[model samples]
Target chain A: MSEQPTHHGDRPGSPPDGRPDGRPDSRAGGSSAEQPAVTASPSRPATSYRTLRLGAGPEWSSGQLALGAVSTGGAALFLVALYFAAGGFDLIWWLLVLVPVLTLSMAGSGMSLGFWALMLYGWFLLTDSGSFTWWSLPAAAGLLVSHAATALSASMPPAGQLASAAVHRWGRLIGIAFSAAAVVCCAAAAIHGRSLGLGPAAYVIGLVGLAAGVWLVRTNPPSQPH
Target chain B: MVSQRRRTTTERSLGDWHPTAAHARAVILASVCGVAAVLGRRPDLLVIAAPLAVAAGWGHLARPRAAVTGRAALGDATLREGGVTTLVVHADPPVRQADGVVTLASTAWVERKPASGIARLDDDGVAVLGLRSLRWGRHRVGTLSLTLTSAWGAFRVGPTDLPDLDICALPLPSAFDTSAPTPHPRGIVGQNRSSHPGSGTEFNTIRRFHPGDRLRRIHWPVSLRTGDLHVTSTFSDEDAHVFLLVDAYSDLGPREGIDGRPTSLDVTVRAAGAISEHFLRANDRLSLRTVGAADVAPIGVGSGNHHLRRVLDTLASIAPATERRDEGEHAIRGVDPMALCLVLSPLIEPTMVALAHTLASRGLTVIVVDTFPEHLVANPANVHESLAWRIRLLSRAAQVHSLTSRGVPVVPWRGPGSLDHVLRDIARRASAPRMSRR
Candidate 1:
């Protein structure tokens, strides 16, 4: 069963201390105790802003700071891999290191798609050897962390202080998502190293695997109410 | 006279859900890019698309199963100007990850704290907005709109508009009072002391004790000195009838709210409230009639606290310039012959002036209260408008002179003590003998 809605405690007309003497104020139509019946909104922490506070200062809590560090650090590590993958000659590859900072601040509304695609292209260009590399595994981990962080940051309001429980929950989800990418990376590396020359049969198996992955992604799960 | 139904608690059914651009972007980018990466023999592209694939999969898996509905209610329906009331908006089957916004559209004379009129829902899917009415009268509080974004801002339900809520804002009465009594006392119960002697507190004289005199009323000192029983006599308490005819034809001046100067209609309605409050508290019978607004509900003659509320409610229902079909006849119909008729008007309307003359012709004590705002003459913003008003007011001056010549007093509303001098004069005139025209 859903929890009963809590009273909005900070109503301006409500008494600051408590119900006023249990006697109705003729002007207010009822006592302070009866005010709860009138103003029954969900309870919120006193610090929560009433409106969406855009462009507000970053009042980072410990949980938010930790989450921010993990997300940006993962993105920065992925950029280092991309630097080596791009042969480390061009100065342009170094600019990719700042994707983490952009993800930290300018995350919302799928705006981080550009950064994600750029990192993927950096990995794609490293395929000049015409063979899969084991380094793709760590690169996958870094990209997954950055994506999860962007999603988390977008979900939160600008001035919102993160609750520890929410951060932990998102962290668990991110871990699970990265684990799936890691599993796929391991399978690809095994297939590439084995040099399986099964020809048309191998192509058939790969196609089947791709189909299954797409089906799993497309399939809807039975939704449960909160 | 504007008639409107009272608002009650209601809930809106869930609105149609639509896929947001954010959701589509994640799905399209993930699926198309993932398939192309495998075709191109690139595992790196697969990694990039994996998280987005998870996002798309999660959104579809966790979409809201049931329809999302919203309910809104006001804590109090009636409020004095500047008094605050709470509005609560709630969504059913709360989506833990969803972000909901509650918006109250901007309305004239209603001040919202945030000014933008938008508020964020708490985790439990409820939002609270405070509304303060700046002016008096029956006003529709702004329309409430609710929008909910669920599943990582992927799926959405409504920016659906809920039903309009209304509030009755009673005018804060202008400070007014009078020690002088009403012109004509007719009813048996009231605070006014009449000429005839009966049961009352104020002493008229001492007389020899009659057979009907109670022992409590006997004056022992007078009896002992005169060698006969004597009793104190007092004037009987009576009540007066006050008939208020409000003119709602024109609302002059800029429609500034309570913080600024009042308009002509504002002055009239507030003056009527102050007069009604003062007389009602004194236990006087009051009746209200509106000439220019026909939609306003009719109020009959009554006394006591409950009747006082009815009077204020009727006053709050006034909508200016609504009763063009109303002639002065319906307003004066069934009015008590002995009642002192108070015609509240700006004197710009000829119908109001004619109504006052008609009341006087019917042998009723009539008084015209000029409710034009002082700022109209003092602060004319433009030269053309000032010139126009000056000419119009000159014509209005002749109308006032006509009413004065017809034995009807024309007095401007000045809040406190505005009617004290006129009411005392009417009472004095009522005491003198006069011939009635046949």
Candidate 2:
């Protein structure tokens, strides 16, 4: 059997000779009486950017950075197409270019909704005032990709290195979202093919859409803590 | 006492599902926008609402219905300092599209991997966090909080803080060994040779064979020379009693955790563990007593490999602080008179110093092992503080000088061979003739 002795008395800051061990010494000196060997931290990958700045922890991996670049670049390309479609680039419109870049900081935040809303409003204004071209379809696809990329980046913590499974998952979702957009585009093409569509039948379609939306909301259950 | 046993993990259901902000946004945005686009006869507007509609529908159709319960556990309940362990958390009835995350709270002397201490749950809703202990003693591995967001971010189960779990991190004993013999050996079973002649491996002398002597004991060469049978006699192996008095009053130095340098308390605990291991491995009876630290439980003396484990466990339970009412009497009471007493401390407190004096005055073989860390004196960051320490240390030096004058050997604890020279010196002194004053 092993022995465990009863707790002994040693007050903090007291002198070891008279009082318990807790009292601080009357004379000056650090509390610790000895120095020990320092241990090295876990090593990082050779390509890590932690070395660039002192006191920095793990940062975005090369894969994450690349994904961000591609997503933002895709958004930029769509913005350029919209610029030409709207007849010219307005200075105010140029601010919208920051949307993709802002996604980096806005990761894991609700601000992505506002950014996407603003981008959607921009396209709405352009198409409502200018000619409605099929170009908007590709523009929607780009925006969707950017949104998914931001969400994917935010899914894990900042210090975490990129996991390929997450990237692939988000990519698949983006594809699905784009495919849905294509179906809407096909419906629009069909609408353009007809001329007498503003009848009671149109009102019936609108009512059905409203009812469908309500049913969807009712079927989904709210999340609650256990 | 609870820390000595491994805790079995228990879990409760995360509860019924509830809608989150993401769900509300998707549903309202899709419904209103899609309806307005249709009424306005704007195909471009419909295109804008297409993805939102899909998101809303997907969220509703795939909402998780099964209840989830999460369980967290440590890979090992006990670990040596600088040893690593896995902290795993798993959710039952895993939600396929759920985004689960587990975070470990920052703890003293423990280093967590990813620095952020966050890990994503896998497809099975399980996550593993790495924990490495930098110092000895009992400590909570930080708060293990869990959160799970269901498909489309529509619903959530929790961002709940789980019950705190504790780990007993044993001190990694400093490397130490000695070929020198102990000064006193009392028990029958041990490796050390005793003074008396008996059945053993070390040869003593040869004598005429007796009726009780076994045939194997006969020395052929001696028997042949004398024309008579002679038996070989050998010294007996015996075990010694070692009593360790540990001072746990002050914890000094910056606690940078496992990745940084050890503090004063770290040095003390590790040294105590090393000494216990050394003596116990020799099959010697060992006992431990701690002064200060109210939380530590009392342990009794014993020997063997199992006893060594108990010693390490007791060391892990140390929390630095002197009891408010104790005068250091009970710590020294009932100690064996023939036992070799080892006082492990930084000598920072008067109580431990007094205890050493009391043990020495009792005429027991007591040796004081200094466990103060060196960093305090080497790095003089603040001039005034350094000067103050210098003054206190000088006073401490006087106390040390007094101990030496009374014939108690004080030795600083270095990793290996730290006690070899002092133990040998004590052995020599014990054998020397001395006069007793009545």
Candidate 3:
């Protein structure tokens, strides 16, 4: 039951001593008689009994904490790959690294989206444009793991433990996504430093692919009842 | 307007496969990086974005199209205190590859199995949450809110609110029994010995045969010795009328529910239940009436297991101090004159004491069971509270003294064998001659 701080005079019909008959009050509702008054200090305000307490935050299960750790680790791995690609560590890396670790609790939120964007932007800015590095494979793995973990975390409450079936299903999907990245990395490495001299066709194909991707992700509008 | 907007948002979300933040993140990153790889001629970006694109595509393909609906049902609507029941949530046409979370809100005296009250749906899209009722009363089970996430957390459905269910928790009566017979067993059907002679198991006296006496009661040895027809007389078995008058005026002390120390009302109700059970099991007619609570229908005099259930139900319905203006005139208006009145109260309220006096004045054998919890005064929080309690208890003692002076026995309830000595005294008094004004 929610605790309500009851005073001697709180009840409407009851008298000051908690007696209904206007008699000098007794300890009826366990309410004490006139309490000894305390003077409030000048430096601090007196505490109000009516102040609402929101209680403690939601407790996280071990499974959820482990998943959060995995997400943070994945983001860290991506940053590490970026550092190796850049051939040096910058002070900005610390701020970038803190984003994923700090937002670990809210992995389901858009904050994670911002974290991924920053990591990918860093990779693009630090690495050479034309050359394909093998580090991209591990970086891709890291990004996928983080994304998968975040999705799983968002599916349930912090206190909810992931079921074994859900874990297996997500693990399988993650493997499939990483395999696709590996295939693409191998294809990119094969065509490195070699030009097939196909003019505006590549750009046209890329635009068509982008349009198709947009259509695939587009949500259908709610149907109106006739 | 806020609620309307929330409803609209919920409807829109449930109506279609809306993208989750994860889906948006994947799709946006894939499109941006894929475009950047082609536009800026960056092969490494394409390699990095490939996995995201595949994930986005896979999630979109696996998105659930059918609208899902959920409903929750309790395993049992009526349970005894401390009984466990399951809150099973069913999702119709179970959506495969979807993750579902059902959250049961925390309610007083209702303990959830996981403590967090969050249960993940099994593969079959059904979630079962265990609820243990710790106290006796009618309680609305916690609001069950369900949310379903499509595969890859790509699309979402409800954080939908399902209809609430109610569970009637009946009090588990404390162990009670008494070998002493109830006073004034007047009705025909029971196990108690009646004053009038008739067909029964208990021997009364040998006398001349009456015309209405059964042939089996005729005694051959008595007839031969007297040289006249005589028959064995046995006391008739009759049931007693027990009127349980529960005082619902004040529920003192902390409401810690059934697992902890009981408050005044808890003690009173449980004691009434135990007494009713004991009497009804012995074929005694029992009726129950509450003095101060509202909406508690008075149980009429009845016997057997069915009536015992009715008595328990009435006891469970009591909400303390809901009707403070009650003078208890209605509670005592139509009580059986021969009934033994058991007024269960902590005597915190003067109204109960007054009611007990009224019952005793009507010449009914009234016993006031003091249901006061002694721990209320023990280990007081402060000196003022303790002193205040001591003064209150002195006033309460005067009330008990008044009732005792008027020949109403006030006994403190102590579970099993609590009423034995008092009942024996009342029965003994019933046999003794006393002066009465005509």
Candidate 4:
């Protein structure tokens, strides 16, 4: 799901362990301590929805994806209103528009999580007053790329062929590219702003997309946990 | 304090993970609306989103821990030789949408979850995942990880530590060759075989005449002239020791049987169990050791329940090495001339066959329980692979015959059946050995 660099294959960083079982230790130099704590993952006869594993954990009373969207959208709206209220209609502000996709539209599965993208779209269409700008195109493009990178992350290889070197190399590149695109796009946005400072818009989108990207990698691509 | 038993622990997990997505959605929605109003200078909607988010998160904060538990029914630890037994794993977690799974520590049992969610005993839960028994021995039945979520993708994961059970599958002894003439002259009840040779069914050894020896005119003139007393040595008539050499080496074929039954090891273990139990009941001293570890791990030499347990434990602990080996490879081949030797193996390679011949040459009674049929014996697919597999099986079968011709009785049969039939068939076909009347 990488947008900018076009990183390839699933699991931006997962292909490394390359264990035939894709067990946590398939990672080289991994010790017994590093083995993902073994909690029973739903044994899917088929390889599809990488099962989400957590025993009802704690989070900010507000949901993560939702909270992030609200925080981000509200910040964007605030910045726009503050500018407008200050009688600054002529200000062409720089902003980032990233599609915070929790998962990509994978080839086989339909269970992919798109909460982040959905909320962001809603924020764009219904709640926010800020109009779209040509300057924001790259930011949105970068976000879409990040979504694709994540989709690649969840893109798993066949179960028996986990250790193939080709898979892991592509995975790492995808992860890095995903993060890099956001950073690089914002840099461009900041440099080429036709308005007042790429503003809070770029910063908010960059923060949410990057944060979600890290989380997606941390949870791992949607494959069976070893 | 006593930890009592559990009948169900399902209701606990679902109650815990029920709110995740909704809470997140509401918070984000409310925050968004609030931020919008603040941006647009409106506050009413933010209030509404906040309460809705709270309602969604209520169950997460309210639910208690240790809410889910399950009770599991166990299967045989020692499967009979040439037999199959389904390890019944019934988990009843006391919650709806409480997903559980079963796993084993033994690698021998190729674990498969063919059925997700079995509605009853027959259904395999590809839906919920089921664990299958692939090998014989003491196996631990432990908890499964379950994640419960709302339809909105709001979910929570928790542990459903189910009640655990241990399964012990014993190895199958090679079928007894009953017709090999029970070395005893009279095997019927009451005609006991004793070493003293006063009056018994078995003849141990002939020696110089002696006084106090049952003098039914025993060599009258020799007894009169020798003066010094001597007796013919003999032993108590009993079943000879038959140590079965199970070579859990390279498997017969792929792990799964043609009909999805189990591996040769699975059949071997079950057979071993039935044989051990049978010999125990017959009061025969039966010992166990693999053809691989025969030199060192000779077991069941002593008669009793203790001996049986020892063999069963060994079968459970023994990990079949995938590396190929032969009769001279290991220092563990247990050879005993006093007992009959039984080799229950698929003979995947010729080295194992050679090892059996070596054991038989050691003056021990030998028998081979042929499991080769489980592997290459048939043209399973009628494809090139199947044909090749068949050839490999045939060669192994030939090796069994070569050993048999050297005096070791070999029994060939199919699994999902009793191994005792091997013993009974051998007894029916083998002619009685010549005996001298005392």
Best by lDDT: 3
Chain A TM-scores, candidates in order:
0.59, 0.62, 0.70, 0.25
Stretches of model 2 off by over 4 angstroms after superposition: A1-78, A99-110, A129-131, A153-162, A196-198, A218-226, B1-12, B256-259, B380-387, B436-438
lDDT of each: 0.69, 0.68, 0.76, 0.40
- Docking class for model 4 is incorrect
lDDT per residue, candidate 4, B104-209, as tens digits?
2223342433221111111221112333333444445334333332212223333233344444433333333222332222232222243344444455665676
Tens-digit per-residue lDDT, B311-369, candidate 1: 77888888888878788788899899989788899988899999999999999989899
Of 1 and 3, the candidate ahead on TM-score is: 3
lDDT of 3 by residue, B72-155 (tens): 776666655655566777776688989988887889878675556778887787887766677777777777888888888888
What tens digits encode model 4's per-residue C-alpha lDDT throughout A1-226? 1111211122211121112342322211211221111212221222321222123421111112332343345334433433433334333332422223222222113322244334343334433343323323232332323333232222221111122342343344334433443453344345442454556786577556544533332321222222
Q: What's every prediction's RMSD, in angstroms? A: 7.7, 9.9, 12.1, 17.9
Best by DockQ: 3
Error of 2 at B38 (Å): 1.6
- Please give the DockQ score of every candidate, comma-separated: 0.13, 0.13, 0.19, 0.02
- List the candidates' TM-scores in order: 0.76, 0.85, 0.85, 0.45
Ranking by DockQ: 3, 1, 2, 4
Tell the DockQ for candidate 3: 0.19
Error of 4 at A119 (Å): 7.3
